[model samples]
Target: MTDDADESSTSLLPEPLRTVTPLTGSHRDESMDVIGWGIFLGLVVLLLPLLPFILIVWLISKVTESLTPS
Candidate 1:
């Protein structure tokens, strides 16, 4: 008996997950980097200052509601 193996068999995973794409183009790399930095800076600039005020107001509301007679 002769043993034979087929090379056409594929796993259940998607092709993109199994393959690696190269990012050698400068424009693609720069665009991706800029987008990532923009998201990071946007969150820091916009949300960082408001977070503390939001927490303080939430805590004050909770305390006031608890202290007030129902």
Candidate 2:
């Protein structure tokens, strides 16, 4: 039997979740390492200062959550 999906059924997916988009990668010598590290370091720089604050808030919330009767 042929394995083929219905085109109308595929259209039910949201735009971002759809696989119909074309592969338009950059036409340059851009290594994936450069892109990966750029995103990783960018997030670190943005979130480093907030990490301690987030941890403290999370700890407090977890403690409160545990103390509350189930």
Scored against the true structure, residue 13 in model 1 reaches a CA lDDT of: 42
Q: Write the per-residue lDDT of candidate 1 for residues 18-45, one digit (tens) a residue.
A: 4486656544678888999999999999
For model 2, what is the error of residue 35's alpha carbon versus the real structure, in angstroms, after optimal superposition?
2.4
lDDT for 65 (candidate 1): 100
Off-target runs (Cα >4 Å) in candidate 2 are 1-30
- Report the error of model 2 at residue 23, Å: 17
lDDT at 40, model 2: 100
- Provide the clashing-pair count of each candidate structure: 0, 0
Give the true-structure RMSD of model 2.
14.7
Q: What TM-score does model 2 achieve against the real structure?
A: 0.49
44 Cα displacement, candidate 2 (Å): 0.8
